[model samples]
Target: MRVQALIFDVFGTCVDWRRSVAREVAKVLPQVDALAFATAWRAEYDPAMARIRGGERGYVALDDLHRENLQRVAAEFSVSAPERLAHAWERLDPWPDVVAGLTALKARHVIAPCSNGSIALMTRLAKHAALPWDCILGAEIAQDYKPKPQVYLASCAALRLATDQVMMVAAHNDDLFAARYAGLKTAFVARPTEHGPHQTTDLGPESDWDVIASDFHDLATQLTP
Candidate 1:
């Protein structure tokens, strides 16, 4: 089926989460260990998401998750953060190719983010990074996260397209697999640095995704008009 729309996974897919968080934290506490702080903060993401998924905790927005993790990491590292520092997650910097690549793709098809981020969080990040999404879709609406078929299908339903008519683009293989299971086309855009120096998985595509690219721009190039 011809792809009518492109849905993106944010965080490490379009934005450099580690680098962006480090940069922002560095601004607030120049002497703080920025890289370590970023990693420590991100370390809590999966466990927190799991808590919600397992019914151990109720649904919490990504922003809240980040803030909660940030506080815990800050105490662990003895880093004193300013009031504005907690908003670092909302101010992530987009990958260099994001704007240009999305601009090129958006010219031909509807583009949006189908992410684990909450609507408010995604909207703020889009405004901060100038992401050219025609719309923003998040798991908050479904009370779930990526790797869940409902999240992918919800995005397609919102766009009024069949599952096969929309494509899911992400840096993670699990995300692509979930989208494929949900009947959407899948694209893998590798983000080798997503998990920083300790990164082990997702260094490259783990599955035979419909399309694989070095980045969004390359994905845009390979996509059919």
Candidate 2:
């Protein structure tokens, strides 16, 4: 069946999370290595989610998890994490191509973020970055994290779409791998510097994803052409 919806991975795919977080850190903690602190804080993200995904913990919003992770990273740096710092995730700037590219795609396909971010987080991030989303869906809807079939399946169900009629667009190959395995079509957009200039992973498509595009603009053309 033809794909009717295009759901995206928001963080590194649509916004520059590393640089954005680093910028926020610099503003709050001028004494520390902001980039390193941002990197370390982000490093705590997956492990925290893994505990939930592994059934070691119950479902929790990512906003709470970010708060917990912030405390941990702050302790490592011997500084108290300011309450406002946790909100940094909500204020990330989008890539230059994102607004226009998504606007183009939104004209033809249902566009929303199927991100790991909680609804509140994604909602604020969307407003802050001016992302044009038809609706919000993802882990919060499924009460689980991605690479899990439930997240992908739940998003499709929420849209009243069959799995095959939805396409998962992400810069991370592993996310696309899981979405495809869960029966969604997949698109890979490279965010080579998501981790930083020295980033070595996901610099290119690792699998033969249904679509591979250089950016969201290229993706819009490829899908709508």
Candidate 3:
């Protein structure tokens, strides 16, 4: 199927989550253990989402999740943080190629972030990074996270496009697999450093994804100009 729109995964895909978090943490607590704090904060992400998904906890937006994780990390490390620190997630710096690559893709297709991030968080991140998305679509709209077929289908439905007409671009293999199962074309862009030096999975494409690229710029090159 010809792709009419490209749906992107924001964190760790378009932006370097580890680096961004580390930088923000360092800025707030220069003498603190930034890397450890970043790692600890990210470690809480999946478990928090799982709780919500498993019906063990109420629905919480990505911002809330980040805040909760940040609080825990700060307490664990004996670091003091201001209330405004949670907004740092929205101020992440994008990968060097994100702007140019997204601009190239936007010239031919509708591009947006279909991520687990909330709309407000994604919006601020896009603006901060100057990510030229036509729109921002998030799990907040679907009330679920990636690896769920419903989130992928919901994005297609919101764009008023068929599943095959849309493509999911992500750094994670599981996310691409979920999109493929939802009947959408898939692109895998490797972000091997996403987990910092402890990276253990997703070193390359794990399935028969439609296309696998070194990064977003490479993915844009593979698609028709």
Off by over 4 Å in 2: none
The TM-score measured for candidate 1 stands at 0.93
Candidate maximizing TM-score: 2
Ranking by TM-score: 2, 3, 1
Better of 1 and 2 by lDDT: 2
Write the number of the candidate with greater lDDT, choosing between 2 and 3.
Answer: 2
Model 1, total clashes? 0
lDDT of 2 by residue, 1-225 (tens): 889999999999999999999999999899899999999999999999999999999999999999999999999999887978999999999999999999999999999999999999999999999999999999999999988999999999999999999999999999999999999999999999999999999999999999999998899999875
Q: Let me know the TM-score candidate 2 reaches against the reference structure.
A: 0.99
- Top lDDT prediction, candidate number: 2
Model 2 clashing residue pairs (backbone): none
TM-score against truth, every candidate: 0.93, 0.99, 0.96
Writing each residue's lDDT as its tens digit, candidate 3 over 86-200 gives 9988988888888999999999999999999999999999889999989888598888877678889999999999999999999888889889999999999888888887799
lDDT (Cα atoms) of all candidates against the true structure: 0.87, 0.95, 0.88
After superposition, the stretches of candidate 1 with alpha carbons farther than 4 Å from their true spots are none
Give the Cα error of residue 152 in candidate 2, in Å. Answer: 0.3
Candidate 2 all-Cα RMSD: 0.6
User: Could you give candidate 1's per-residue lDDT for residues 1-225 as a string of tens digits?
Assistant: 689999999989999889989998888878788988888888888988988877788888877887777778888888766656768878888888999999999988999999889998889999999998899885887788777788898899888899999999999898898899999999999888788777899999998999999887898899845
Model 2's lDDT to the true fold?
A: 0.95
